[model samples]
Target: MATVKVTDLAHQDAQKMLSIINNQMPQLINQLNSTGQQMSDPNNWDGPLAQKFRGEVWPQAKADLEKMKNSLAQLQQSVQKILTNISHAGGA
Candidate 1:
């Protein structure tokens, strides 16, 4: 067995990346909600196939989108914790 340690992770870069992650999370959720509403609009479907897609495929896509949002939320929280830890550790 070998002991391994990680060092040299730039705090400024981590903070910048954290800023981006925080800013984009809401944007992504808003986009998903807007698109989901558009997809649910009945007027958008013209025929049986389109209706089927809206009814069937769209649900899975929506579920996946929800899962993605949840994962992003978790990641955001984790990143926030990391940033807090960084600050506590005398990082930028």
Candidate 2:
């Protein structure tokens, strides 16, 4: 495969994307946490459906959110490495 050149623009774009992810991820987590709390609260919700949701769906969603966070962190690290490499190469 032909090696693609990494430029300053690419690094800038990657940084911007990472910035967006950093900004939005917390909002997503907060929303999930709020919803989870609401659903888990007996006063707010308590029934067979709520029990099933609290037992099943909430955990899966939380786990998936954690996985997504890990994946995004990996992506950010990879991008940082690429940016560092490009900087050392004097390409950015």
Candidate 3:
């Protein structure tokens, strides 16, 4: 049977990455929301192209953002699971 090894440093690094992802996600979401709001404002941007973007492209972008958020959450969960496994391996 093959052996697998995980180190304390790996666990720490994973935790740090998880923290970074958790922190950055909110900022990303806020930026996207602010951008969407700014673009949606007619006073800020108004034209047929803007309307087309708001009606078509904007919704797709929002959906893509939501998908990305879900993907990040999944990644966080996977990292948490790895941390749990590492702790169980006596690396915690």
lDDT of each: 0.74, 0.81, 0.87
The residue-by-residue lDDT of candidate 2 on 22-67, one tens digit each, is 7887688779878886888779988999999889988888788888
Off by over 4 Å in 2: 1-4
Which residue pairs in candidate 1 collide?
Answer: none
Rank the candidate models, highest lDDT first: 3, 2, 1
Error of 2 at 88 (Å): 2.3
lDDT of 3: 0.87
Model 2 TM-score (2 dp)? 0.75
Q: How many residue pairs clash (N, CA or C atoms closer than 3 angstroms) in each of the candidate models, in the order given?
A: 0, 0, 0
TM-score of each: 0.72, 0.75, 0.84
- The worst-scoring run of ten residues by lDDT in candidate 1 lies at 2-11
Candidate 3 — which residues are off by over 4 angstroms?
none
After TM-score superposition, the amount by which residue 70's alpha carbon in candidate 3 deviates from its true location, in angstroms, is 1.3
* Predicted structure 1, TM vs. truth: 0.72
Cα misplacement distance, residue 39 of candidate 2 (Å): 1.8
